[model samples]
Target: MDLAFGADDSKKRKGPSKNWTEREIEEELKKLDAKIEDAKTNSGDVEVRDAILDKAMFLKQEARDYPEAEKVFREAYVKSGGASKKMELLFEILLMNIEKFDIDSVKKDVTLCKQLVDEGADWDKKNKLKIFEGVYCMLIRDLKRAAELFMSSIATFTCVELMEYKDFVFYTVVTAMVTQDRKTIRKEVVHSPDILAVIRDIPFLRQYMESFYNCEYKQFFEAFVEIIDAIKRDKYLQTHANYFIKEMRLVAYRQYLESFKSVTIENMARAFGVQPDFIDKELSNFIYIGKINCKIDKVSGVIESNRPNKKAELFTNTIKSGDALLNRIQKLARALDI
Candidate 1:
């Protein structure tokens, strides 16, 4: 499976797959339908029905009939009344339906997975479920939660042998960058030698991590663009490219704000290679959302950074020191009396 996403700029992430001949597909579907009908008619066992449906789903998937596979998986999962094996099948359905980018189905499956975890599902299954849930959050533009979830699953990724390990690590780094959560990266990603080894080999991921960590905003943006370009060809990621771009831009904006006292929107835009109005709009959004402690002067077209109140901070620190000294003196006096 060549999951190495191409830099395809097309918005349509999927194309027809000639996995099976039409006649072969029709023959398999007919056989699976008869089997399913017989199972329903002769067997009252829900497991038997679910196994038959699963076989039908496999045939659909083999024929690259993703929509039909999704339908069959959903029916089997629901009709089985939450069987454990069906939950695994449901995850397959989630993977197959990525082109549709259905948030509702993802959420429903996440809820079911959480319930399964609570009921003592294996740690490996729980870890995979968490990663999938993080993907759901990313698709929904919840970058902060996505970063947290990805970071929390780092240990699992280290111990587990996942076929999609490359995508998992790539998204982990991407989500952390989008949210600008360096502390989490430092703790969860950088310190883990296992993940570090994997990332060091991948040029783009390595560049992203180094650029972000080294405060090379321009390099970071360039590498980010490359990442986004590659992601655009992926069936699951293309749907959220715009949102991902917006979040990554905010990260760059935040980094720039930290280094300068104030900067004109035009100048910042020029530095970032974007339009002045786009930078202004982003700065305005950050201010509105309380994501950045800054003020935008619309008339001057500059964003002024909100410096901390050093005087107030000094006074608070002085008070804390005084209280600490007084406590020490009291302890000394008690010792002397004793």
Candidate 2:
């Protein structure tokens, strides 16, 4: 599915509505509207919900009336019966709404969907929601949580309605690379049989992950450029392309720097397949922000790792966190001292 990189592998657009003319679609939608009225008149709630669902789908696909479609979808959900029925109907509603990427609405609907699933929804339904929610998390820039959700659902991916299996694998691997630690990425993404099965089909993405893992910085940098292009083209990731690219470059640079107390700037550039000046400028910005924890010797043209001692860093962070918490508590106490 290389969903972010290219066209979707297959969409669950079930109907000839797309092939029909506007007038033809309008005529067919009118017929479905009549069917909905007939179901309300002579059939059960299930029949009415089914009829409304049909109309909603028609509006979404044929008429291209998303607002109307969503309204009708809500009608179907309202008519839906029991936990299972509501779960099914809600997922339908979710798919339509998620396409719009209305962030606040998605958050609320996903939360509601979670609640419904918790009320004993089937395993299949639960797994499906995980993928949807994972995609939603990715869209919102919560890469860590999105990676967690995506990795958890890989073996049981059945969200064909949401995306193709290969696309799911793509999202899972990309997010894992950025947000997951090396050991976790090795365990959950690099060596996962489910991911390995189709990863080669996504050649650049495979290179992006595997090259970094294998310490092939040259290959990783080559793949990184291709991936940035794909991310720029992706509707879901376009907004985050610059951010993602910068982060990934840092991932490569940090990994390379971790192995050396000091490395010549020219050597570091050669390793990343970039120019010495480019590496110097890149490392300077990161070092200024304390992002890379490194020092650059301009005259000697050497880059030095200034990473703090792990235990000392950890202790400093703990004390800072505790002091911040205590200040907040003291502030509260002073306000209530009366």
Highest-TM-score candidate: 2
lDDT of 2: 0.83
RMSD of each: 10.2, 2.5
lDDT tens digits by residue: candidate 2, 1-338:
33355233234445344577878877898899899889999998778889999898778766777788878888888887666677776777677777777877778878988888878878888898898888788788888899999999989999887777777888888888988889999999999999988988875888888999999999998988887877787656778788888888888789899999999999998988989999999989988887899898899998888888999989999999999999999999999996
Best by lDDT: 2
Clashing pairs in 1: none
lDDT of 1 at 160: 27
Model 1 lDDT-worst window of ten: 6-15
lDDT (10s digit) by residue, model 1, range 220-276: 767777777766765456777887777777777787788899888888777776788
Where model 2 places Cα greater than 4 Å from the true spot, the runs are 1-26, 321-337
